[model samples]
Target chain A: MQFFIEVLLGGLLSGVMYSFVALGFVLIYKASGVFNFAQGAMVFAAALSFVGFQNLGLSFPLALLAAFTTMVALGILTERVVLRPLVNQPPITLFMATIGLSYVIEGLAQGFWGANVRGLELGVDDVPVQWLMDSTGIGVSSFDLFGAGVAAVLVALLALFFQYTRIGRALRAVADDHQAALSIGIPLQTIWRIVWAVAGFVALVAGLIWGARNGVSFSLTFTALKALPVLILGGFTSIPGAIVGGLIIGSTEKLAEVYLGEYVGGGIDSWFPYMMALTFLLIRPEGLFGEKHIDRV
Target chain B: MKNVIPLKKTLAAAVFSVAALSAAVGDAFAQAKEQFIGLPSYRVGAYAAGGSGLYGGWIDYMAMINERDGGVGGVKLTWEECETEYNNARGVECYERLKKKGSTGNSVFQPVSTGITYSLLDKVVADKIPMVTIGYGRTDAADGRVFPWVFPMITTYWSQATTMVKYIGAKEGGIDKLKGKKIVYLYHDSAFGKEGLTVLEKQAQKYGFSLVLLPVAHPGNEQQSQWLRIRQEKPDWVILWGWGVMNPTALKAAAKTGYPREKMVGVWWAGAEEDTVPAGDAAKGFTAAGFSVAGPNYPVIKAIQDNVYKKNKGNMEDKTRVGSVNYNRGVVHGIITVEAIRTAQAKFGKKPLSGDEMRWGFEHLDIDAKRLKDLGAEGFMPNLKITCADHEGSGLVKYQQWDGKQWKIVSDWIEPDREMVRGMIEESAAKYAKEKGITPRDCAKEG
Candidate 1:
């Protein structure tokens, strides 16, 4: 029972991190209608920028401000330069362009930063904060608790923004139907720029916290891929689904690997999540929260 | 009025210039049919930081050979780079793409990845292409009798792991003193990580120490829980077998866990500028097993400056970090490949030779004192000799510690626990051969 509690907490913490990255994916997909394959690369690029600014010996707060500013500019530039021309192209073309965008971003990041892993300081000591109950122990990291708090705050802020703001109303209009939204005074292009900028800021925050836990490297990009099934399990267009899906996927992956791996020679964590997500897809084609769509083929 | 020629005249002049340039290029191409070496660099992938420096060093050296010495044996050598992105499948594609150049002479391969090395072992050997896996490869493949074309040059995981145990034994006073000492093996869960486990297990049995295996996930970013468990268990020594981001991250976790860095040891693969550069002050006193001695004043490096750089032959600018471990490995890789070619040149006489001939050269390779002096690698590494059975050349390693600034070698070159190594290699190799249905060759009968 003690082991189960520990593993469950471990899963939830990891799930929160996954949800953070998945949130970036959900934002871009909801607004741009393109699966941003470059989200991992964005994570890497954002982390590299944050680390680079920090390495310049700037104050941590100043470095963070500069990194966020840079990410906003980068988000705007990506929309203007890379996605603007392909606005009317087929969805496949848009998807392929994002793949190419991932490559270009990775290459450029390496060119600027060179290929070295960097450690991030999250302004909190990484020491474990232990808790004991009746001679039984349930220890958790202060850093992890801090991460969960940050995730909750960010999600609440996003929810409030989407529910009340004028731009939020326009974004919802676009998500319902781009053509119908364009029929009104809501400019599709401006809405996209806003959406991308928001997603990029989220990526920057995710990168900072993730880099704080694990040293940042080019391999950080692979984490975006790990968040793929999260999109499937949670509806790609639903923000709340992203968090719930991430937690479920993350917790289940840990539990399966810990309890079931011993019987099958280990290393089931890599494939088990995908299998579970596939089963969910078969059962709920529109995803856990996705609205069912009728295609006029 | 005085400005420009007519459009027709300008076009005519441009065509004539183009014709002349093509004629000159043709003559140059005729004069020297270039021998091409394919370099599959992992400069933008998982291990790109380590890959970039080594690839830069190697490409610079090859450029030097062409500019100063007019290539090896008077056939100018040129190389083209293919980014593998550190994927084994992509590396195989790069090999196929570069293997077809007509002027391809005894080419050498340095994949810098063990997974790719294992994937290419059979293909390159069958294709007769020489693979130079510096510092890491399959341990059993060191027996050239079974694997004739593959060369793991200086140090292998088995040898380094064995040597690390030896160092620990010495540090703890004696092997018997380690009977009850708890040694935790904190490793990345990959082929690269699992490679040294067999050797450590064998040493544990021999030395009577308790071994606790802790397997971390790939890319190995999250380890707070593992470290907490380690703190709880209080292992005496921690052996880190990790790569890329895992190294510095693990060190930081150790620091957070309040574990002394002096008691931790990393393998040669984990020892580099990239690993320590991240965890700056916290990683002080951490030790790793290094196979080669890389320094500023080595003879070969000076020779490179004199023979290759001074004449503007190689890319020997501030970019060429010769003293770094990865760069040294690259330089040694170049020396071994060139020596094997030279050895083949002695037997097959200078002209482009076949892969089997190169294989013969690798098996009967002898790099003695005179050869080292000739090759400009005297103090960098000890003389190496590869034979039918002895594929690793020599099971020697040195201990290095990070002083928050740079790596300083602390121990003299120590031989691996050979008796333990031999038994493990033979048993594992036999098991591998049986699984693959490969019969062991009787060397005495073959001669």
Candidate 2:
């Protein structure tokens, strides 16, 4: 039972961090109606930039600010270069552009910073919380708890911003119909630039946490795989759904791997979440908080 | 008219210079004896740090050989790197691309990946090229009679696994004390990772210890449940058979679960500076197995610093990594390869040899303690003696522990239990031979 609790809490904690990346996807998909395939690469680039600046002898806060500035620049450049030309093209075309953008961003980061895995220090040790372990006999990581706290706070703040702000409403209007939004005097391009910049901030935060855990390397791009499942289970257009979906996916992922992995020769954690998300897709295509679109022929 | 006349004369002079350079290049190629070794390297990807360090040291050693000894028997070593990006498909494509390049058409092929090695097994055989899988690839391929085209040089996975057990036994006072002990075999969930489990399971049964199998998926970034399970079982030790980011992640996870780093043992792939440095303090006291130690104290290494880097012919961007674990391993690889080419030249000629001739050279290659001392790599790497029947020249392993900064040698050289390892190799190789319809080579008749 203690072991069970440990695994369960560990899963929930990781699920929270996954929501951070999922929020990045939600922002762009909700605002622009285009799936940003480069979000993962952005995450990798953001973390690499943070580490790169630190390596250049900047303090942690300066590195963070510089990395955020770089990310904002990357977002604006991506908006002007990749999206501006293909504004009214099919959604598939924009997604394809993001895919190419991912490669370009990866290549650029490699060129700018030499390809070497660097360790990241977020000042939080990844050791288990001693009090929790002593009291409940469950070893829960303190760093994970801190990660979960940061993610939850960020997700809640974003949820409120979308719920109350006029810009957020304008962003939604652009998503519903680009021409309709422009007809009502909403700036589609401005809203998109704002959404991507916010996504970049999200990417930066996600990268720092995950990079601190896994070391800043090319593998940072693969966390998008987990985020996809989160986006699928939670609505891609829903902010709070990301948190709930992350919780569900994270717990089940750990439970299934621990309980069922041994019977299947182990290492099933890598694919078990995908299978669960696929099952969710079959049950609710629109997801819990997702809007149902009725197409007119 | 005057400007046009000058233009024509300038164009004529440029064309003449080009022709002269081309002729000189052609003449140089004809006059100089050159051996080309195909290097399917990974220089820009997830495993780039290791690839850079290894290929850097390998290139430095070859450059030193050329600068110090005027090449092996006056045959200049030439190589072209085709980036595989650590992908198996790219690795095979690189093999096909580099197969027919130089005078002898890729004298030897060494793809530093087990996945690539497995993909090229049949292809290398058909091409009559000898593929050397040093410390990686199929363990059963150590039986040279059935696998003449492949050399799993130095040590096989089986040897490493058995030696790991032997070292653990020595720690436990005696092999007799291994009874009733429980060990967790935490491995990467791949063909390369699973190779060690067979020998470990057999050893578990031989001794009375119970073995628990745990598999970590590729790019193992998260491992909460796995470590939690380790805490529950409280096994005597954990054998970490992982690669890339998985190594440090495992160490960090172990620290998170309050598991002792000293109790964890990593494989050679998991033991490099790249592995430990990333985990920071969590990686301290972690031990791992290796075929070579890391240091720049060796005379060969000093010569490379003086000759290769001093002359601006060095390959490493980070000169500090000249004596890193992966770098030293690559130097060991260079030592064996250069010796094999030297040995081949003695039999074939002082020129570029064919792939088949290189195979013969590998079979006859022997580097003892005296040769190692002469080569200035005595303690840096173990002695090796390749035979017609045994492709794995020396199934010797050295253990090292991480002291927060660098890997410290923990034990003297330990040889694997050859009697048991050889039996398993022959058994598996015979089955493979039957499946592939390959007739085992008669070593005596070849001589």
Candidate 3:
């Protein structure tokens, strides 16, 4: 029972991290109706910039500020250059463009900061919490727990921003109907840039936490693929859905690998989440929190 | 206007002379006696760290020879590095692109990747080019009769596995002491990672230890569940056959589960500084099997530093990596390649040897201790002799432990259980040969 509880907790913490990356995708998709494939590359670029800044001996806070600024600039540039040019085009064309954007971003990141693994110390201790382990007989990584807390705070801040701010209202209007929002003088282009900038911030947070957990490398670019299942589970446009979807995928995959993987030759953690998402797709095609749509022919 | 016409005429004459000079130089390059060594290098991708050091050392050593001695026996040695990015498909493309590049053709080819080696084995055999995989590749390639064109050279995975089990047996007092002892094989889920399982399984049967197999997927980062299982099962010892990011991640997982670092050992691929450095202090006392010495104190390294680095002709991005483990392995590879070329030159009269001649040189190659000293790499590598029957030469593996900073040699050179490993190698090689409809080469008939 104790071992089971530890596995469950571990899964939940990891799932939260997955949600953090998925949130970036949700923010972009909700505002623009475009599936941003370059979210992973953005995460990588942000982390690389942060680490690169730290390497220059800048203070942590300053380096972080610089990285965030860089991410925001990148977001604005991406919107103006890649997204704006391809606006009103087929969603598939936009998706393909984002995929191309991912490659460009990945190449630029590696080119700027040579493709080598660099350790990112967030001052979060990775050692198991002694008190928790002693009381529960299940070791839990403090770093993971701290990451979850940080993720929650970021999510809350995002939720508040989306609900209260004028730009947030404009973003929602644009998301509801881009043509309608444009007609109402909402400045659709500016709304897209703002959303993309917000998405970039989310990518930065996700990158720092994930990079701290696993040393920053090109591999972080692929970790975003794990969020695809989270997006499917949570709805691509629902922020809260992303979080819930990530938790479901994370926790269930852990439990499945621990209890059931041994019988099936193990290593089910790699594909188990996708299987869960596939099953969920059959039951709820619109996703757990995604908006349902009907088209009249 | 008159001065301008004269100046234009002079400029035209100068341009004509420069063009003629370049044409003559091009003709000289065509006629220059040189051997073209094909290097399928990877400077990018998941395994870039290892690739950089390995290919860096190789390029540096070859360049050092050219800079110092004007090339081996006054015959210039030239090489072209074709980037593979560690992808097998890209490696094949590199091989095909560089195979026929030189004046005579590619003298030798080293893919430096097991997957690439497997892909190129048939192609190299058809081309009669000797492919040196060194410490990693098909273990069955050790059987020269079956794999005539391929040479694993120093050691193969089977040998390394057997040597590791022997070291474990010695650590536990005796082979009989391993009886009922539980050992887990945590390996990367790939053909390269799974190569040593059969040998370990055979050892488990011979010695009565229970063996458990666990496979870690590629780019293995999150292994919480895998570690949780280890925590539950309480395996006595763990043997890791991982590469790239899997190495440090496994060490981290082991540390998280409170597993003893001393109780776990990694294969040579998992033993580099990059593998353990990321895990920080937790990686201390982690043992790994190694075939070559670590550090830049070797005579050959000094020669490279003085002759190549000092001249600003070194190929590595980071010069400090000159004596690192992977770099040294690359130097050893360079040594083997140069020695083979020299041997071929001695037998076939010095001018650029063909791919077939290089294969013959690899077959009859011998690098004794005296020869190693002469090559400025004394005590760096074990004395090796490749023959018609044995392509692996010396199946020796030594154990090293990471002491927070650098690897310290913990055990003397330990020889593998040759008889046991040889039997398995021959069986597998014969099975492969029969499947491929290859007629086994008659070693006795070969010179």
- What's each prediction's TM-score? 0.85, 0.96, 0.94
Candidate 1's DockQ is: 0.30
* Candidate 3, residue B335: how far the Cα is off, in Å: 1.5
Q: Indicate the residue-level lDDT of B147 in model 3.
A: 91
* Candidate 2 residue lDDT tens string, A1-297: 777777888899989878878889999999998899999999999999999999999999999999999999999899999999998899999999999999999889977987778889999999989987788887788899899889878987787778789987788888888999999999878888888988999999999999998888888888888888888899888888888888888998888888888899888888888898889989999876778888999
Ranking by DockQ: 2, 3, 1
lDDT of 1: 0.78
Residue-by-residue lDDT tens digits, candidate 3, B1-447: 979998999999999999999999987775458889989897766667677888888888889888889888888889999999888999999989999988888878898889999899889988888898889888899999999899998888999998888888888998789999999999888888889888899899999999988877776777778888888888888998988777877887787778899999899998988787767767888999987878888889999999989988888777767788889889998888988989888999878889999998888899998999988887788888999989999998888999988988888889999999999989999999999998888988888
User: Would you list the rank order by lDDT, best first?
Assistant: 2, 3, 1
lDDT of 2: 0.90
DockQ scores for all the models shown? 0.30, 0.70, 0.48
Model 3, A107-188: lDDT tens digits are 8987777766667788877778889888878888888889888888988888888899988888888898889999989998
lDDT of 3 at B343: 88
TM-score on B-chain, cand. 3? 0.93
Model 1 CA deviation exceeding 4 Å by range: A1-8, A53-66, A85-93, A129-139, A247-264, A275-297, B1-36, B63-77, B102-106, B224-233, B280-282, B294-297, B305-322, B346-354, B368-379, B426-447
Q: Which sections of candidate 2 miss by over 4 Å?
A: B1-32
> Candidate 1 or 2, higher TM-score?
2
lDDT (Cα, tens digit) per residue for candidate 2, span B192-296: 789999889999999999999999887788787688778888999999999988999999999998889998888999999989888888999999999999878
Q: Is candidate 1 or 3 superior in DockQ?
A: 3
Question: Worst 10-residue stretch by lDDT in candidate 2 chain B?
Answer: B26-35
lDDT of 1 by residue, A1-297 (tens): 777776778778878888889999999888778899899998998899889888888888898888888778878888899888997788799889889999988888878877767677777765556444225566556777788888899899888888899998889888888888999889988999899889988998889878777667787787786688888999898889888988898788877766775576455566777899999999998789776889899
